[model samples]
Target chain A: MTTSKPTVFIVDDDASVLKAVARLLRSAGFKNALFSSAQQFLDEHDSNASGCLVLDVAMPKMNGLALQQTLAAQNSELPIIFLTGNGDIPMSVRAIKQGAVDFLTKPVNDSDLISAIQNAIETNQTTRQARSKLHELQQRLATLTPREREVLSHVVSGKKNKQIALELGTVEKTIKVHRAHLMAKLQVRSLAELVKMSERLGIISSPLE
Target chain B: MNWITIVWPMMAASILTLALLHLVVWFKQRQQVAHLFFAIAALGVAVMSGMELIVMRSVSIPQVVLLMRWLHLPLLVVWIAIICYVRYYFNAGRLWLAWTACYLRIFALILSFTTGQNLFFSEITHLKQVAIFGGETISIAQGVLNPWYIVGPLSMVALVVFVVDASITLWHQGSDTARRRAIIFGCIAFFLLASVGHGVLVHTGLIHSPYLVSISFMPTLFAMSYELSYDVLHSAKLAERLQISIIKREQAELDMQTQRNALTHLSRVTLLGELSGSLAHELNQPLAAILSNAQAAQRFLAQENINLDEVRDILQDIVDEDKRAADIIQRLRLILKKADCQLQLLNVNEVVQDVLKLVRSDLKNRGVTVNSNLSNNIPVVTGDNVLIQQVLLNLMMNACDAVADAVSIEQRQIHIHTRWNGTAVQVAISDQGTGIVSDDIERVFEPFFTTKPQGMGLGLAICRTIIHSHKGQLWAENNNECGASFYFTLPAYSGETI
Candidate 1:
């Protein structure tokens, strides 16, 4: 998580379109990158770059939808905004369903493209933040001992120390000690906060009857 | 003058008139050999009538014999003419039979000249004056009949058989003119046989009568004249009908041409409709660029510290994009305009490149690539520019559709080739799609024939008509390995100032 200005990565097979979109983004005081084709974007793009993708839907090979699928397979968090010269209803619907932030037709209005880019960048930022937070939580969860991990699950499931100890064949004193250690390792002070952290990490199920 | 003198000369004069009439007809239309043969036959008949008149007035055996001796010459001429006339007019009859009849008649003429007083008599005993036509006198020869006289009757028999055979064949041909001609020939045959039978009876003295062979042939001449006159009248009517049909056909052709032009315009509009999205994209690229550049320049202008150099670059780009958009519009207008055929000298390669530019984006969108091999030194062709462009555009669009579903990128290529082959400029467009169905190759150019589900089937038909009107030819053939190729040739302008 480096703090930097988000770049709008624009991919279009048409050089003029790519240049025009890049110019518009630059005029809007946003940093931007340009790729002439989907293959070029795939080959040259920086996966670690903090950005939203502005893609042309009708590219020669590996079109916008295919690129979207590829990035999704790679777990890339870059939000996509589609720009197509001829956007039909079914195509726009498919793009939207595939998690595109916006499907705009060309000659796109400057305001609409800029707003779409802004929304896409905002989404990317939120998604990136949540993903980093989850990563940090997983790192912290990995440091817990097996007994402490079991106790954390029982605590998150709304189990009492006595019930946890009964399930684990331990005394209430040992269960309580494990709960404190796991909560401290997870950096949560209150029981509710601990449960929330466990849930974030997907540590265990909630309490049943 | 008595009846024999008046009537015989009148017969000669009438027969000579028919001969002159046919001679003039043959002179005007030399291809009518039948007319020429009929003229000769009538002339011989006229001469025979004159000789019979001389023989009928003869008072001595030597005079009658001498007159009868040369009369075989006219008879030989008549027989030859009849054989040739029947062959030419009816266009039937056995060749061997006709030749036999001619040779036999010639043998009789040679015998009459060489060995006998005449073909019918070896020697005349006396010249007998007979009063038969109400006190008019004519001569009858009492003679020992020439043993070879049977040759003349035998020849007549052969001529009659030949004519009857020809008439029957002509009748079997089953046409109006042929049936009429056959009936006329049948009457001539009967008259010829009757005259020959009468000549045989008179020569053998079976009946007491002056020789009337020349008079007996008059009916045959009349029948022939009737047939020939019928032909002349029928042909005149046919010529009139032919002229009317020709005018009607030209009118139909003009109407067809007008309809075709309308259809061509309609199809061009339909093609534009199909390509509207691509053309919009084409125009939109420049427009989008211009908008973006202008907006970007506006933003720069709005800045407190304006970047003059950046603004200048954006303005330049805007101008370039505007020109690009204008070019696309100009092309669209050229294609969309409806006009008549205006032939002018055009560089084929330039038109090809222009059409390729128009369809470039559409083809790219469909993932089809076009490769061109154009000869630099090819001669200019004469044609309507927009129509030629339409042909090229239609073919390229069809090629794009052909390769739309190709499995491989390599198979999605269209090749356009142009060359100058001495007299004409030839252009060939080939595609690596599924080659046309073998049976459909020729039918592809026929109107309303199509293989595509959404096709109007007039594209190739119109293309062929356009090419043909330019004095060019269009054809299609499947490539040896795969795909199909369409070829067209435009005649090269010969530098004639028109």
Candidate 2:
């Protein structure tokens, strides 16, 4: 994951704006991939790749908002940064609520744009890291027996071996074996590490954490 | 009774001549009043001649004269009809309207009936022998005039007044020189002279015998006929001249308006030329999008796992965007198209919007905010669309420049409002910029006059010209305190009445 190079994708309906922004991004020390429309970007998009998207809010056919919904439906984690020429308040609020990384008004200052792009890239990296961890956790879970799977869920829920035994109607010694085997197979050395992994994978959100 | 030999031929000739004159008027003009007068006169003469012959054959002299006196009633009725006919021929029926002359004819008929008892007519000497040119002796006694005789003169005076009133009406209505003086007025003069001859000669003691007045009738009647035909021909010529003058007036007004609009448009075109880079930028987006979409479609088709449906949609989008780019280009080109100026009709909103597009970036650069409220259902107005757009662009550009000059970014606002006027559309483009002084307002639309250092001053003048070409009006007025509002109006698609 660390070996992959990062790029900022720009999508705009206006060519002059597209060219101007593309030039600005290049000047700001960013590798930029350009698309004129959301559809065009989607057609050539590699959802698995880690990158930040710069999408214009107003566009023909498929706008930036619709593209966001499409990406969400596909569960793609490429963080989006919205760019709008006519930036109204309602649209900004709506975009931010829809999980947009940032909304920047056009003819934006160079420092402001670079900062937004950096934040988006960092967010995308975090999302990809979390998704990959989930994949790894799922792979580990596939090795578990039905009984072990049940014991694993209870154990993660702050259940002691004795509580697990009482809940599952099993002996303490048997519960101990299941816990030891689950911990080893899950590759978790501590309960805190396991909870953190689960939280990051979106399996659960602990109030205490 | 030599009455048949003496009176019948002459009565027949008079009646036939009256009928022929009426036929000429009717056939030439297709006028209805002439037909009416002809029927009444011809019938009156025929009936009176028949009664005279019948009375002479069967009745004694005194009784015959008594009965013959009543024949004057029908003849009086015919004479009154001639006055009405002549009045109508000159288009005078509506002066008093209400068919007042016909009512007067009825009064004359009733008076004619009462005239026998009243001695509306009487023989001065019962047995006077008068010599005839053909070596024949005839009892040609002159008839005495009575109170009923006053009706004929009174009717003539009223008729002459009716004609004089028409002439005055035409004068007040401002007819042309020839119509006011020569034809229409002359017609009244001729009619008054003849009417007075028949009306007042005997009562005023100007003539002893009616034969003296009778001699004037044939010549005057023919003269009146010729004068009326002349009036018709003259009216036709006057109407033609009026129609031409109206067109010329309109054209002159249009030319003046066009001059103003063209000046304004020229200024706008110059301003737009300066913002050509921004315009290119606006157009380039769709062009680039079209290219990118085309490239994407080509790549998808070339690939083994080509999504045909997606590619087709992409191609459709490419085409659509391409057309969009082309349309923008076309609209921009319209401003630049070395077009020969033409005038026609247009939806004002469409023209306004197109012109706005031409200068939108300049407005943005100047930080001027423009708000437009154009009624959707405004009637199609007649004007030159290109020139109209040119006018709007000029005005808007001027507003933007004025805003820049004032250096008030927050108040650099323009409002365009339109609504349907009853017979016109009122359009106002107001700007909150530095106001033009009261003294300068009137001179703003003059050709080659500009207050701005860079301005050609032709802007407002050209706006005026274009507005005038559309048969509209344009002017500049100061806002409440700080700005100027350019107001204009266009005539709606209503029709003209005759």
Candidate 3:
């Protein structure tokens, strides 16, 4: 199978491992960076980034698994591929403890690295996409006026403008004005666009979505 | 000339000696004082009665003079004891029964206005004056068993009952109650003996006169008189002086104790002053968190009308945080409540946690690492929690301070352990810092000794006090290679085998 460049974050204290992993990823056409230690990885939490971690199982200051802990603490969804030079069952047990993407030994098989990276990159991309959609919806909702937002609830309920006006105890003209403003603020040109906005933003998921 | 003529004066002397003994006992309720006085009084009654039987003689003016002199207060002293001992022994702390006795005394005094003639009628009647055994001649001032005399002795009995009853209550309330049982039995025995002695003089006509028969008991009276007058009086005087010396000593001890207590409290206050920052920070965090959370909810509420469920959740959070704030305040107040450690059943784990919190920042500042491997399931033990905390804190702090001049940061490590040993909870607080020499462990609990340049040497001593208060054991020992460990054990009481 044809594989694209897979993004991985390599965290370790040994300068050679950090450099070698970064070079290996570069050689394999993988987008990667070298974080000297776990503390540095913690300081650089990027839920917006599309990547996974290639961590050293045991490092001087902070081991690979401990960095995984730091990532978990920040509530990031980036996948992790634990790569320890000196591997053991206990280290593997710890790596798999927190839903790691994959556990691999140092000088990992190029194919295994590529496949795991592809999987992690794909997962991270999906997370980013979902987050962007939610952000867009939140921004759109933020633009709507207090009154227009109230009317917009009724509009989503498939109520006609006149019916919405009657239900809200307001004039039909006022209902029309509110609906237009709501449509404009939500950046939806039509009713179909509005339903698609609700679906895409996960405001309301369709039963068959 | 017979035993009857000699009886009045000797009885009066016996009563006088007894009254004096009672006075000393009343002032100084020391065991030696009381035992000496009472034994003297009982012996006096026994001896004077015996002497009257043995020696029959005439009434000298001096004898009448002595009888007249001692007439006033000895009976009164008996009544006083009846009231005082009864009140004390019963722990009644009430004066009504005693007050009634007082009034009855007044009534008896009022009735004595008619002269003792109505009480004891004196007659020089002719009778057989036999020098041989078995024949009796007597002129006697016979007592009528008048209601007044009966009132006094009966009231005295009532007082004994009051004391016995009080002791019974004490027996029920106290744990080691054999002492109370002994007291009650002793009083009961004496009461029976006195009643019989009084009966023999009144009804049996043992010597053909009340006064003469009493004279027959003179030898026994003197033996008792010697015990009472000299032994009780002298020993009681000695006991009184000893008691006064004891009181002075106790007073001095109490004064010194109060001073030491004041100093300790002052030192603690100074210690708290040093801990003011940590205390303030500890107090302020929850308060600040409470304020921020409240404001966040308020902002959320103000931005738009909040949902009922969301509002309810916010309110619940506010209530929970308020309780947290209140708990911080309560804990702070409790810590500052002036070292009054009341004894109760406490979980050892709590003491460990509390000491850690109190000294956490201090240890951090000193770069000392404390690892607590507390047994969460340690059983609740009977002890003073704060005092145990104090003991733990002292050891930890001493460890921390001891390593101040040491080389490595790793050396300043403190480890705490809690364990259940079937019948007791054992807590071991160990520190890998400076270790005490083997010679010093035995004398460490002694007062006014120190290895440290600035220490008062009272901390470990006081720790022993607290441990003993809980019926627990505290000792220190060096670990296998290095460091020192302090282990204390608290007993699980009354079938608590955890």
For this target, which candidate reaches the highest lDDT against the unseen true structure? 1
lDDT of 2 by residue, B180-266 (tens): 443544454565467457435543444432222233334434444555455668888999999999999999999976665455556
Kindly list the per-residue Cα lDDT of model 3 for residues B1-498, writing each as its tens digit. Answer: 544445455565666666565566556756434334444444444344443333234344333323422332333444454344334333442466566656655555444444442222122122223343335453223333344445444544554454455556556576554444435534543553465356445432454433332333333233323333443455668988999998999999888766755655554554556566555544543443344344445544554555556546556655765676577667556655665446677878887887787776556445577788888767677776655666777777777776656667567677888898776788887877667888987687787778878777877887787688678888989888777888888886554532
DockQ for the candidates, in order: 0.39, 0.03, 0.01
Q: How good is chain A of candidate 2, measured by TM-score?
A: 0.82
Candidate 3 residues A1-209, lDDT tens each? Answer: 11334457777664544554454455455677678777787777454556888776654334566677877897878888876544668768877988798887654555576678888888877776777777878898888888887787777768898898888898999999888888888877999888777776655667696
Error of 2 at B477 (Å): 7.8
The full ranking of all candidates by DockQ, starting with the best, is 1, 2, 3
Of the candidates numbered 2 and 3, which has the greater TM-score value? 2
Poorest 10 consecutive residues by lDDT, candidate 2 chain A: A20-29
Better of 2 and 3 by lDDT: 2
**Chain A TM per candidate, in order of listing:** 0.93, 0.82, 0.76
> What docking tier does model 1 reach?
acceptable
Report the TM-score of chain B alone for all candidates.
0.59, 0.49, 0.48
- Leading candidate by TM-score: 1
- Give candidate 1 regions above 4 Å deviation: A162-174, A205-209, B1-259, B344-347, B371-382, B406-413, B417-426, B480-482, B490-498
Candidate 1 at residue B133, lDDT?
Answer: 55
In candidate 3, stretches whose alpha carbon ends up further than 4 angstroms from where it belongs are A1-44, A47-209, B1-246, B307-311, B339-341, B360-369, B376-380, B400-413, B421-424, B434-458, B468-471, B494-498
Per residue, candidate 1 scores C-alpha lDDT tens digits across B1-498 of: 688888888998998899899999999999998899998998999898888888878887888888888888888899889888888887889999999898888888888888778877889988776677587667778879988888888988998999999989999998998898888888888888888888888777776676678887898999988889988998999999999999999999999888888999998888778888888888888887888888888887888998999889888888888999999999899888888898888999999998987887788678778889999989888899899998999898888888999978899899999998777899999999889998999999998998889999999999998999999999999999888999999999878874
Q: Could you give the CAPRI-style class of model 2? A: incorrect
